[model samples]
Target: MKTESMSSIPAGNLAERIRRTGASRVVLQIPDGLKREAVPLVLALRAEGIAVAAIAGDPCYGSCDLALDAVALTGADLLVHIGHAPVDERKGVLFEHLPFDFDPAVVAAAVPLLGGPAVGLVTTVQHAHLLDEVAAVLAAHGIVAEVAPGSGRTPFPGQVLGCSYANARALLAPEILYVGTGVFHPIGVQMATGRRVVALDPYTGDAQEVSADRLLRRRFALIERAREAESFGIILSTRSGQARPALAERLAALSEKAVVITMREVTAAEMINFGCGAYVNTACPRLAYDDQVRFPVPLLAPQEFEILCGVRAWEEYEVDEI
Candidate 1:
């Protein structure tokens, strides 16, 4: 297990910053996987005379009910979320810090010898901190690499959740192999770039190569599973009308005509919290990409939802449609 130290200097600076801002109570939301380092940061803050509390949960993406319950118990005036971004719908001031260091030498040495003219770089928010360094290393390796620009609509600052890499991959020029880490991030890049991707394991510094064909087949499987389900659930957004309600209504009406059981409603934390069998989103379609939410059910877009709901020959829906 590779590990990096959390910033004590920044922690102190953050403490002073908070003190100047007059916040008395501080909550440190640390992901369970990375708690080994994060615990010390919380201790450092407590030593600074700042009332600090630690909330433990998986920081992979979404809010865990146990973590949320911990936050409610803390009643913190300021929340410092470590290792992940705020996946909840509630809007508030929160700080996110991802403490993972990618060895530049590892990235440089791992550059593929066979890929075409260009290379695209994709990474999750956790590993995004190393983009500049990795890009520089790739440049030195005689490979021109581009960092896929994130979707501008990320709900959290410094956090690109839900198709973030997809947005970046879409923006990339063709004939580029996207380099990413782990199954989720690389697969996301492959989905967006429509190209082969190389995934580097953060832990062992190993590389895994994935082809575009495999990703397409995986997506087909997800769609097929949704199609075989009996009841279809549609999630609506209380915010937008043309986007959420229109899409939800279309899905509901289609399900009714097909004699398939359909359920529709506004997007709620609980919908994810309690876990459903299958759901289609009328709101942000990017929710399908956020694995951190730990959605117990398969969530798809309207068209994908239709396909999953067994609507034969359903047209594919674009992410921008919602």
Candidate 2:
């Protein structure tokens, strides 16, 4: 789809860059959305006289989930990771972030929802490139958007991830403007900062105020139901950037009924198989918040588990972040 990035090689120079890597064989990884282009992508490299050893078939949610094992088995010298920005540095892995472009002026739809003269602006990696343009659009509408730099995990200024909202909280503005697709990010920001947030869908020009009230209500009820559980399985992810061993261990230590369980993928089937009545997810924080419906049992976030154990009060509630 005519992508443009130094890391994300356009078809014109795809072969040349692979040759520059000095690798005899390469392993390619693409996110689920771009998997359909796998054949053409491989063909393009082959036409350029590049040796593509493999295309990793597993679901790649982000650069956080690396296919190192695929590279190791295929004896490939380099890994072409697509569709995400680098969350951490790892040798032999090249991050090719695919940025989604849209008319920045579409952010004007949020102007009506913002309260103050200024607001904090943040977005996911796909839309991070348009942050400055989005700010300019807001500024023209008598609304100044503060585009703050994010943590190392999110290198781009004003970018926020599902597990990291440092950029939103860094801004001096009272309210937040999130220019991205999903309500998940804006909802998380609202919960994280307890500040007003308006989510703007850059592509659709749809804007709406974000609230955590509904999510918190559901979680609060789930926490109550979790009390009936005889035991809790604390899930620890093995994904490169998502693994929080210390946090998982600490959560496991909170109660005698809790025990740490290592899992590459926390599926409903696996949870049912583990036989735990409830789970305390320390993996990708989004799993506990976003995909809870897929599981039959209650999956609690680290912060919710704290409230359940009486270590943290409900009044001190906060969203789970890495």
Candidate 3:
């Protein structure tokens, strides 16, 4: 979704960056869509006399799941993670954020859609690098674009992830502007913060005010379907990050028919094999929200499970984040 992702030739010299690490052997972990570029990159590194010890084949959605195990197993000095910003600190991992750039003036597309005097600004990592420039553009229009300092999983100021909308939630404004491609993050921000959200696709300059009403209606239907489920499978991720074992255990305890299942990848077939009428996903909150169409059965978030169990009321509905 970024302007120049690994899908295209990456912006910086990755080999040079790896060489700077002083680590002779390194593991390369790339996202699924970017794997097409892996062979060329590996060959380039090898031709430069750098030993690429391994290329992790695991599905990598974010920096939250580093290939530390691969690095350790292959005796590699470190790992060069591509396409995402770092979610946490790890000694043996290097991140190439590959942030996207767009016309800073693109903030004007969202101006007419913003309902209030001041607005909080949040965006995906791709657009994070241009936040200050975007703010400057908005300032000319007499709009204050508030960007909160990074904290928790989202380390870049004004950056918001599908699984974490903390940056947007931290804003003090009544309305928020989300600069990115998709409606999901903006929808999540709206639900999580209970604030009006305007989403602008920086590349396309398309802007719209996002609403969670449709998503909530769908989730409510899924919850109703889950209430009739004979068994519940609370998914626990075995990845380096995205693991919520304690939360999974707690959700599993809610129902006698519920059990915790550890998985590296949660697939639709796996749910069918589990034979549970419904499943609760603790791994990657996006699995429950974004990938519900791919799943055959109801896949509820942790909070949605609480709602179904009568622990939380419908009015208290909130988006899942880790």
Candidate 4:
């Protein structure tokens, strides 16, 4: 497996750039998964005599409160966010990077021969470890395969940032096939590739063919219905809405006229970017949970959302249905 820096980002220079911008007290926020790479960067800033602090947690992709607390505590003039871009409304200098690299050999191996002239490849961060191997397999099979860059991970991949497979896919025209472990990767790949795809599980090396036309049709229908609905709110929660009963009840009632989804289902950053008019969360009461991310629309508790949607009061709604 060949590992290379995914982003052409200059290191050590960020602190200098901030200094030039007259910014001091830099707070570096990184995902819990990327601590190994993030730590050294933080220390480097400190070595440069720049005030720096590191926070360990998910950053909820800039939606968690701990992220907000880190910003407030550090009083950071510049926020060097590693792994993720800034999702919060708070304005500051933000630096982002794609922490994982695709193995070239994996990318070479996974192309399929039966799919005619060319193929499309897609995978996630977890399966990205196998890209080179998959690539090698493709080359050996005498099949031309292309990978798309920046299709996954926030900011709409190619539009705002670059993703590995997405970059490759854009560069080459091929029949699309995704090398992935689960539904999400193949689904996303199909959405981006605009082709029927073969999904491969990197761990087990198992493969399956997937069709996205049906799924996309369903999703589009749902989105259209939701958009036209008189009212809409989402029930926000982590994993599931297991913790809050009142919130769930209110959400169910609100759903009659409005669309409701979980926080896990929709990122706060996405909500803000999508321009959703209203949202009622059952999870963390704060908009964007921890406050690292902010919502532009009106965010209220489930009860408030129900009222806005003109649904029955929380007590009048059936808790069991929630």
Candidate 4 on 40-61: residue-level lDDT in tens? 6666666777777545345343
Clashing pairs in 3: none
lDDT tens digits by residue: candidate 1, 104-191: 6677545764263566665556666776777787778787776555444333222334434444545454443334445655555555
Worst 10 contiguous positions by lDDT, candidate 4: 155-164
| Candidate 1 segments exceeding 4 Å error | 1-10, 35-43, 53-75, 85-92, 113-116, 148-162, 176-180, 202-205, 218-228, 235-250, 257-302, 308-322
Q: What is the lDDT of residue 295 in candidate 1?
A: 63
User: Which ranges of candidate 3 are over 4 A from the true structure?
Assistant: 1-12
By the TM-score metric, which is better: model 2 or model 4?
Answer: 2
* lDDT value, candidate 3, whole model: 0.88
Clashing pairs in 1: 62-292, 226-308, 227-308
**C-alpha RMSD for every candidate:** 6.6, 3.3, 3.0, 12.0
**In candidate 4, which residue ranges exceed 4 Å CA deviation?**
1-22, 36-41, 53-59, 62-69, 85-91, 121-174, 179-183, 191-194, 200-233, 236-322
lDDT of 2 at 46: 81
lDDT of 1: 0.55
